[model samples]
Target: MSQHAEQAAAFVLHSRPYRETSLLVDLFTLEHGRISVVARGARRSGSARRFTLQPFQALHVSWAGRHELKNLSQAEVPQVMAPLVGKALLCGLYANELLQRLLQPADPHPRLYLYYTYLIQELQQSADLEGALRTFERQLLENLGYGIGFSHCHPGCYYQYDTQQGMIEVTADRGCYTGTDLLAIAEDRYETVDVRRAAKRLMREALAPLLGVKPLKSRELFIKTRRTA
Candidate 1:
């Protein structure tokens, strides 16, 4: 039994070298979830796919296979995609890494795919890049069924996520999320530094267990670049 997809919406999650000149590409697709495919001779000088196949690029792809890894027959840019640079570029990579690490292969997550596309678009022009990422992270967690609570609390109160007890309201703010900040973060109102920091920490806490012991390379890279810059 063979399977085939034609001109399906997709984004390249990661691409790495294979035997000789080929590329083993991981793709997140609207119709088919995460998949791995070999882009034959993509390293050749004239292979335009070498340019088209990359992170944050919107693509329409055609693939066929019977086994897990598919044969990518065609990949084309669906439209003009504005390139993401600097912080936005890094954010795009982080999103890709999250999807690669957390999402299972061959499982369709249409809503998550849509959220991912919107996140890429938002990162392009968002004044608050971290806000955009936090929004995406929240959506990612919800889509994966690890929904974190950020509602129904006092304005000045603080809270934290507890696996055994859900959202636990706490007194001290040192390691807890303030109700005001939580509301703002939940609504994407990243106006204050306090709110932004709280959102970042909350996301880290929620993602830590799912991500396991291994640290995200994206976080390390972001920290290193900020220090040097």
Candidate 2:
């Protein structure tokens, strides 16, 4: 049996060329999960869908398919978001890459979809780029059921996070973090550099297992850009 959707809220995660004049688009939709759709004639200069299908814009897309790859019938931008540039743009790409890698297709995560929308908006406006990335990373991990707990110790204590064992209290010198920093991160209070750094380390540890062998290309791109600049 075939399936069809109308005006589904979505954003293009990534796109690549297909055939002579079409494009294969990966989309993150509110009603559905990650999906691949072929945008016929999207590569053609005169195609209107080509413009509307770019990332960071809110789209109302219609598609149809019985198999994994769908045919993108129509797409229209209901709202245009502020364009992300520099580091924010890289962060946006990183988020998209994470979703494409970690999330399974056809698994609808409405809350995550909303969080992503908010995350993109936050990245566009927030000066705290690391903090914003950490917040979204934490949220994504939590939503995927790998949430880390920070409530195990008192403010003066020290703790270490283990991917297999969660958070564990440790001697002060051996500890990864003081309880104060952990608490701040738990509350999303990334006002200080220390908290931001701790959050980044913790998120890296948490995401490593899920990501497995393949490293994120966006992260590689970011690192390369940083080295050249």
TM-score of each: 0.92, 0.94
Candidate 2 Cα outliers beyond 4 Å, as residue runs: 1-3
Over all chains combined, what TM-score does candidate 1 have?
0.92
lDDT of each residue in 1-229, candidate 2, tens digit only: 5565644899889888999999999999999888889999998999987777777777888898878889999888877777889899999999999999988887888888988888887888967777777888888898788989876857988888888888899888753788999899888899988888888888988999999989899999999999999
Residues 1-229, candidate 1, lDDT per residue (tens digit)? 5565544799999998889999899999998899999899998889998988877888899888877888899998878688888999889889999999999988888998998888888888755678778988998988889978666766878788786565788887668777888888778788898988888888888888899999889889999999999
Q: Rate the local accuracy (lDDT) of all candidates.
A: 0.85, 0.86
Winning candidate number (TM-score): 2
Best by lDDT: 2
Off by over 4 Å in 1: 1-3
What is the lDDT, from 0 to 100, of the residue 142 in candidate 1?
88
